[model samples]
Target: MQLKTKSRLKFTIASLLIVIFAYILSNGLIIGDYQIKSLGSITKLGLDLKGGVYIEEEIKGENISKDTIDRTKELIELRVNALGVNESVVTVTQQNRIRIEIPGVYDAENALKQIGKTGKLTFRGPNNDIVITGEDIKDASVGVNQQTNQPVVQLKLNESGTKKFAEATAKYQGKVISIYMDEELVSAPVVKSVITTGEAIIEGSKDIEEAKRLAGIIKSGALPVELVPATVKTIGPSLGADAIPTSKKAAVIGITLVMLFMAIYYRIPGIIADLALAVYIMLTMLIFTTALKATLTLPGIAGLLLSVGMAVDANVLIFERIKEELKLGKSLRSAVDAGFNRALPSILDSNITTIIAGLVLMWLGAGQVKGFALTLVTGVVCSLFTAVTVTKFLLKNFVNSNWIENKKMYGA
Candidate 1:
């Protein structure tokens, strides 16, 4: 039984090492068109680390409700989207304020102009006559046309507003039904037919971009209240670009020191813990890039570093328990088992509380806080996996192989 368990444990370690190496090589070395694009792609960045324009729009008006703040947020989000800045952030701040962060964008002025307007969604007749106001519309979505390779914004009318839309479409079929945001003719769809139903398609054009912008505007819906720009601030990406190299250096130093400490303190079990930690790190990166689609910010890198400490702490706790058991004259094999079993409850209780804190941050925090919370949560989850399962599995195999029988090496 002992020999069988020992062989199985070694095989398991070897298999895990092979799988980890294969995963890394397959993702990094395979270079197709798609792979090449991915290679050039810097990981998605958050507002602080990537650095772009930061604009604050103060809400004005008497008796401004929570709903009004929410509406302003939605409208600002739409305008930010119209600016063609990808991965923008729009958040509602305290004291009736809205904050906008546009990441990795160069033309701050253009982006500012795009979002600085009083958002108005309008529908116009063929002769540029006003048909209906944005308040009449209920919902809008960007959709792909099955028949034609084009995008369209499908608008839904309010129940009471259906008659107005039907009448407008009846007179405007085969003519341009223009949708506007302030003076901009966002969508000019040629009406196909006149129907009483509330649905209408704002057709895409030779420029698919216009369709996308219109879609964002319509999808944002009408703001319940108007907003005036209170403040606008722009930060250059150059600053973020400078900080990234520093973050990378910190990550390297942090990981290297942790690995060295583990090996020096715990000997064989410490070595196993280090190996598991490596696996933990690799898996965390893979999940961040491929699963959660997280943007790695400087704070996010800091969260990763913190998690490395937590992972090491978990191992230290378990190893210390083993040492205590050995001091009580327990056998090497029994000491290892009792150590894990005894330390587990405390380990679980501590990390579970931290995980709860992470969940709260994810709920209430936006932008960088969200990124930091997400990375920390992922790290906690992966640490539990590595410390509890991976380390235990490795130690079980090592002990069964009769590799280290001395209680001194176990740090008794």
Candidate 2:
């Protein structure tokens, strides 16, 4: 009796803790000067969800190879990331055009300035003669100047570039060599000595971030083909404005109905399953907001709802197995253990297959499809844990407590 009392107390404490944690995470907290934003507020929304700018640029060159197109697409992605634009998508579409979607950017001109450059990097001599282009550069990175503790952009040149730079440094020993990107002067560093090692540094950046940005732009290299803007438009948030509230309402209603069904039909075990479901939702959202920093979209919400159903299904499977075990006259504890053991394989088989599909979509799909796959895979994985671990743990504790041992209460 003492052990049962302890088990009951443990279950009560654990359930309350889970509920409290979930509430805090969802609603956030504010105390005096400190504040914590809700998970939903921090989670990034995609172009469709938040509305932003869409740009289509045509590759302006004849006989553009697939490799060139691919390289340009990669550079564009790098440039966008360097601009601190998260959740942006760059894709090579039909008709030799590239499509870019940047969320939360309303100004089309600013967006163009951020990503529309051809990024042609060049080193010009004293008389404005081209010394070398970005093609001869091997790599570019940000480094610190040990003497002044200031940020600098370091450049490494290829063998040909090294020979050319060696000659230029020897000729213009004390003169300045300007670096330009798309005719815009980036830096003008004096040739201190004849550098035969192919290594150079540009030191005039205001801060480390500026130096890193310059390095990132240099590393992205020049676009293989010129890109002409085909279309640039700012997207409105009208769809998202309506979709978000509707999605929240639908989710609440659907989950409430599911919870009610489980509680009314499965009795005590149903209530435990609902608790596990809550934990699953909290865990999945935490992953999206904190761990993955994933961008939520409309399709992603669909994936989330689908995973919720799967979580409920897993609990249903276990409850039905418990009913079968009770019919065989097993004790409540034995039935609970046997039910989980019997249901685990089926649950694993279904969830694992779905996970595999989600991964494939994530690997190959683009834009909204990829978002859907990410959410689906994350939610399914979380569901597996909640169903196999959390629901089982709670049911085990309830049975051990000797609180309700009636077969009917176990859904028999």
Candidate 3:
């Protein structure tokens, strides 16, 4: 029975180690033919750190209305999304100015060319009655018909539009009112009702995503003024290449120093802490890369390193408590249990406060601040798991082994 129990324990530990290893290896070292490994095993690259193109757009239009700024920002975001950059930041600054930051970019001219395109609005009748415009649109959305599960584009009209739509549709029953973008017919909703509620539905959509994009474009409305590019700065791929290596080196050095410090100060418990730390880092990377889809920027890398320091601090507190227990003549196993239980309150308090900071950063901060918030949050969570659960589990198993009788090995 004893042999079987030992074998089961060993199997469980080995399985957990394998799982931990595979998770980290899969994220850090890209496998197969075309996949490339991430530059940071835990550290991710950001746009500013990678040095992408920075474009400043000066909005010069009619009276600078808040709606205009809001609309322009949304349109630019859509355009950026269309370009397939994955992680880009577009925001409005003071004086009718817009800033776009694209990281790891090779070209800026093409983006510049696309940015200035006036998202024009047009409405044509079946007999080419160009009686209305996009300004008449109050709101638009993508929805699904509950009965058929078919996708649709819906447009809600303004007061003036409601009257106009009622008159037009009442007169031309079966005729189509075609919505165009650059002379391309996006939707042609046939006159169904008088549409007095200022709302109309465009059916015949193929999918939900396409319907949503079309709805967003229509709802963005017309630009009050033309957006001209005042400044365009393209950061080359070389810029990213230069900083990536430096950031990687920093991460390696920081984590290695942390591991060494923990081992030296805490003795055998420190080794277990180090292993848990390794697991913590890996779990953090997994959370960012898989769950949040966070773009690992250099600043983000810095935030994660800072969180690592915090994680080690938690272990240190518990270890100090264990040492105190040992001095009181407690057995090694009893010391560990008492130490963790005693330190629990302090660990929770500190981590919870930091998590509050991370939440504030994510809420109020924009662009790079979002990255910082993401890394900090992921780190705190993974660190808690490592310090509280992982270390406890490993220590419990280790204490059960027959050869582990010397209290001195535990710094007793």
Candidate 4:
């Protein structure tokens, strides 16, 4: 074999290896304690599909400012995201009521308990002089006491908080400074001396776990207004289970048709396109399940499907251009190169516009809209990769191997 041919063969083998690795990850193979969770197990499903917790919380007080309501929503979003509920939506209704939907969670009561807390954390001296509030703290973390070997909550103060806390500690040395959560005293520890470093540790936690929990709540920040739970709803996984098979069937059928269309019309090029599309889907699923920590909702599926069409559309555009170039008397390699180059401007313009729209929807939209936007954006990005780089790579290898010198094989 020619050295060049041998190198091409090795490259093909490497490409196949990558595809196999991706397939295993997509299916989530577990080896001993180390496991790659399958896409179904790895990806969470949304409330509409999987049914978890739905909560309607009314903010107390009359005529709450929109700013406060917005702030509350942002805070709730942070809290849910922090709690690993990546797909949860926290939105404000016109009535200023907050609606929260979290999918795939089983412990509704515990979730509610943590989420419902006002988290109005405050640090106060023995004389009840406030040293700082949650807003003044830059960050909170859990640690172990070096001297007493007790679990502690460590707080890092902002500039203003540092000044105030230092003053409080200096003035109230040997007296207790109380840590309050939602106006209830959770701990009171004696101030040892002036804390000039802008850091304080609350050392009365029962254990490291408790200290960590407290730190998480504090990091979520306090709500501007107290929230009273008005209504709560829960859904089971039966809805998701029923929806999956139907969705899967539709997707399988649709992709199969796409695969057939490409292979029939574009011939060998279509087969290469099919392989690229397969890799695109695998990478997209891996990103959705693990990297984004996102759940699949019905609308998310729609987004994925729409993206599949867009991916196919991209390839169609490039293939048509390639055929046009070939008719214009360009060689297969030259036509392939020009096709990609000429098609990129159109492809980028379309995908960029869609991405812009998706971003807008993500910023202002809630629930299903957000899910759709996320999936659409993800799909468009992956499509760009497969349609451009992957397709180009495969075709280049095939051409380099001298496998198809026939003009008819180039869809001529």
lDDT for each candidate structure:
0.77, 0.86, 0.76, 0.82
Q: How far in Å is the alpha carbon of 407 misplaced in model 2?
A: 2.0
Candidate with best TM-score = 2
- For residues 45-65, write the lDDT of model 3, one tens digit per residue: 566666777898998866788
lDDT of 2 by residue, 1-412 (tens): 5878988998999899898888888899898999988887788887887899889989898988875677677667766666567878788876788989888778888777767675778889999999988888999888999999999999999999999999999999999998876666667889888999999888889998778767765665677678889999898988889889998998899899999999999999999999999999999999987899877889999999888888888899899999999999999988999999999999899899999999999887876788899999999999999999999988898889988777888887
* TM, every model: 0.72, 0.76, 0.72, 0.72
Candidate 4 C-alpha lDDT tens digits along 135-168: 7889888898888999998889999889988888
The per-prediction CA RMSD against the true structure, in angstroms, equals 7.3, 7.2, 6.5, 8.3
Q: Which runs of model 1 end up more than 4 angstroms from their true locations?
A: 1-27, 31-42, 118-222, 357-371, 403-409
C-alpha displacement of 362 in model 4, angstroms?
Answer: 1.7
For candidate 3, the 10 contiguous residues with the lowest summed lDDT are 36-45
Clashing pairs in 1: none
> Which portions of model 4 show Cα errors greater than 4 Å?
1-7, 31-33, 62-88, 91-95, 104-114, 117-223
